[model samples]
Target: MEAKGDGSAEADKADFQKMIQGMLEKAKQLKPEELVFRYKGVLYPSVPSSVQTLQALGNFQARPEDLVISSYPKCGFNWVNLLLRDIAFINQNESEDGKPGVRSQLKLLEFENAGNYEEMKNDPSPRIYGMHGHYNNLPSSIHQKKTKILVVFRNPKDNAVSYYHFCQNNPLLPTFSSWDEFFRNYMTGEVCWGSYFDHALVWEKHFDDENVKIVTYEELKENLAKGVQSIAEFFGLSLSEEQIQKIAGRGTFQAMSDNAEKTHSSFGKVIFRKGVVGDWKTLFTKEQSEEMDAKFEACLAGTKIGAMLKYDLYCKE
Candidate 1:
């Protein structure tokens, strides 16, 4: 939002102030250990105030047309965003500004902007919102209204590594001096937005729910056309093969990187680091890799999600 030349400088700054104000209020109430909360035996990177906020969110009012895109930090949230926008705008006339989504239409649950929330609350139907909240922390309205929810998850190995670099670059989060420190914090769920395992597994329980849909980052990356088609189908959007191809083309890493304004805005450039699968291999040492594997095995031994997510800490190629 500092503008640095993305063109939306003034507006970005205002929204950033709101986000910072929200985070500071939560930060003010944090105890040394309360920087993260342990709920249901899983650690979450939320302070006491946010925990209260999460409880309050249980009463949040949601509309039937609202769609919540949920995921842990750095776990393909942006990719899903781009894909969703492309799906929605594929055959339609492009915006006059040539942006992805209507700037005023976007909403975020994790980093709430008071201005944006007011706008979103009064906005038209079929509003799309993004959040990194765990399933238990989501609004009760989500279940009550049966508002369509899409959970996009990535392999934890890649997720952790991606998050480590993200912390180093993003001003909002604490920067780590080394990958070792970052990995230790991540394994213990000390980073912002909480544990990837908890976020994914909690949402996994709702995979069978009629209003919920889950997609893996690996599957999306492996065959984006198929991924786009599956997402379109889930969202009940109709598109032909040509349209699907167009969406996939524009949603690619290179294309999105080239058009950051349309893809990611307000500190989003830093969010667009290496968009690849299995980059964790370069970052993780043998011992760390084995440790993560053990943790994953122990945490997800009998859960279907272990396989559903294709959980392999050490992936070659």
Candidate 2:
């Protein structure tokens, strides 16, 4: 199937909207990327045009109050989304001392009010967004405004293993057999999203100036309470003890994976194989693990990112 020209028959904005509607009406006939809710790593049979339109519509300019969560695919994005949602809920109807409401934090969550990056950048007050885009690709306006970033990463081995499974089911990411092939691409930074080290380096380099912060899947899984609290402090929000428990409990891999399945959420890749860290130990041979570690060290040693990573040494007290 060939890509269709997005009908530009209309000269005016109103006419463009009409054509977009017409295109969207047939979007289901096209594919996921043509849909309004398309994410990367989700290919559409008819997508090149859709991708262009999406890029134009979703360009984020950034805001001083914006809270952007950046990560590669399968990098605890849902967990962070759930955490922020719960935090926002807790902050929604608090008492004078910022105590949480007795009712369920998520009970009233309509799950709307979030929009595309472009929409989010223009919104009043604080805006929160989760992105799988690389740092270099971020909008110039965002950099100009010095937008805050919360980054998340997982162990490369486990990340690769999970990515393999995800791409196996994903229309966008190629499903390849043999760890050698996958590792080759992964180490070369040619995998879907981008290189893990590059992503981590961008944050570490930018963190000091832009309020950029990082969290690890290992940390989030090892001590979820600390993870929640760490996130709270980073965002300059206070969480009650109860709210902490709720977010941590719900943000766990098991809980979030269950929620994704129950809600038929966008990140179904997260649910299919929500395995924990150290899965690398099971999946990678000793030589493979050592090879990856060597690559990581070669890529990031002595950098600020090196201080930020926990990797196989995660959970060391």
The model with the greatest lDDT is 1
Clashes of each: 0, 0
Residues 123-169, model 2: lDDT tens digits: 45566665566566565666778777788877667778777677566
TM-score of each: 0.80, 0.71
TM-score of 2: 0.71
Against the true structure, what is every candidate's RMSD?
4.8, 9.3
Which residue runs does candidate 2 get wrong by more than 4 Å? Answer: 1-59, 94-125, 266-272, 312-317
- Weakest ten-residue segment in model 2 by summed lDDT: 103-112
